[model samples]
Target: MINMKRRTFLKGSVAAGAVGAAVSAGLLTPRVVLAAWPSAAFEAKSVDSALDALMGSHAVESSDKISIRAPDIAENGAVVPVSVTAPMSNIDTISIIAEKNAAPLTAAFKLGKGAEGYVSTRIKMGKTSNVIAVVKAGGKMYSASKEVKVTIGGCGG
Candidate 1:
């Protein structure tokens, strides 16, 4: 009787270990995965082209709802502080792009419900360029821009 109980306990432990391993390997996580590959706006040559690719041929209007804050003159082009804020509700995402930089797209933020649509980060500017904030709201695109002067050359400008 003792030998039988030991065998049964060992079998149960092995089964539990296998189930735990599977669950840890994403077998139990509920994930809604996207099928398509993510698009890259950074490699695009022009702002319009990057916007077109990002917005998918949709018309984007300039709006005051989105505000882009950056220094008019950046003493150091290597790292320029930039911030974007959207006053509107239901903001899906916020993307920051530098027009004249070699890689246009600097950073992107995906906003959640009840979360403020604001992002601040340092971006490298090759030269004086327009820093654009593209906000996605109500399945539409809106943008605003501010020109930032990069006095000290960064990115070999």
Candidate 2:
């Protein structure tokens, strides 16, 4: 049996508590705590509003450099696989928009400097809609869209 003395236990607990307090106070940090998780953007009813909430504006130009790899007809809307790739320069972020969903903004991926502009994930869709991929590069937004037809509806039919 490992016997932890009362004084030693109290000291250890106090040290641990102090460390936690320091982290919370920004004294020790890489800043892992996310108190600002963009809830308003995800809950937005329309695509424009979602984009505004997320990135301050929705105006974006079409770009041939961007490509979306998704099935022309998704057998199930519950987990339709989608991938966006942009073999371009200076990509800052990649955001996916489901144009007809209740909350159109489905996913947003922020990239570090020089990181590859590519993301893949499964997203839910309520009906047939154009899935738009918006990429931010050099402080400008470029986009591309692909119509995805769903067979079995996922977002509340």
Candidate 3:
């Protein structure tokens, strides 16, 4: 009975130690696990410019496969829900950009095989602007956009 209990405790300790090490090493960081952040795209002035920087010059023409979801009229600019979904095989990434916002690009998502090419989050809008969604699939770039009207300032307009 004592040996069995000791063995169980040792197993638990080893597992806990491994988890702690992973977390400390940043292997379990939110950004790592979530695979978010491609800052260059979000900071670009226009959708084309951002996509050029992110997907490179080899990118092809935009397609309708990419979808941008957002309210046509945002009652409040502070927290406007936005979602991007690209229905394409071998989708490498998805990016969101707010055209009129000060920062422009909002978020980027890197996806793996079998991973869903979708992301939903709230982005602040300085005023009415076009929210763009760019998706990289099979070494090509596809994009879509929708205009969102903001009632109150969110990005400090």
The estimated TM-scores of all candidates read 0.69, 0.73, 0.65
Kindly give the number of clashing pairs for every candidate. 0, 0, 1
The Cα error of candidate 2 at residue 10, in Å, is 59
lDDT of each: 0.71, 0.77, 0.69
lDDT by residue (1-157, candidate 3, tens digit) is 9999788667755654554454446444432333345444444445544544455432446677778889999988888999988778888777788877655767777787689888899999888999888777776777888999887744533
- For candidate 1, the TM-score is 0.69
* Ranked candidates, highest lDDT first: 2, 1, 3
Q: Which candidate should be chosen as best, given TM-score against the real structure? A: 2
Scanning candidate 1 in windows of ten residues, the lowest lDDT window is: 29-38
Worst 10 residues of 2 by lDDT: 26-35
Q: Candidate 2 vs. truth: CA RMSD?
A: 14.9
Tens-place lDDT digits, model 1, residues 1-157: 9999788667755644453344346443312211232233444455654554445433678998788889998978888999998887898778898977755767667787788888899999888889989888888888999999888734433
Q: Which stretches of candidate 2 lie over 4 Å from their true place?
A: 1-35, 153-157
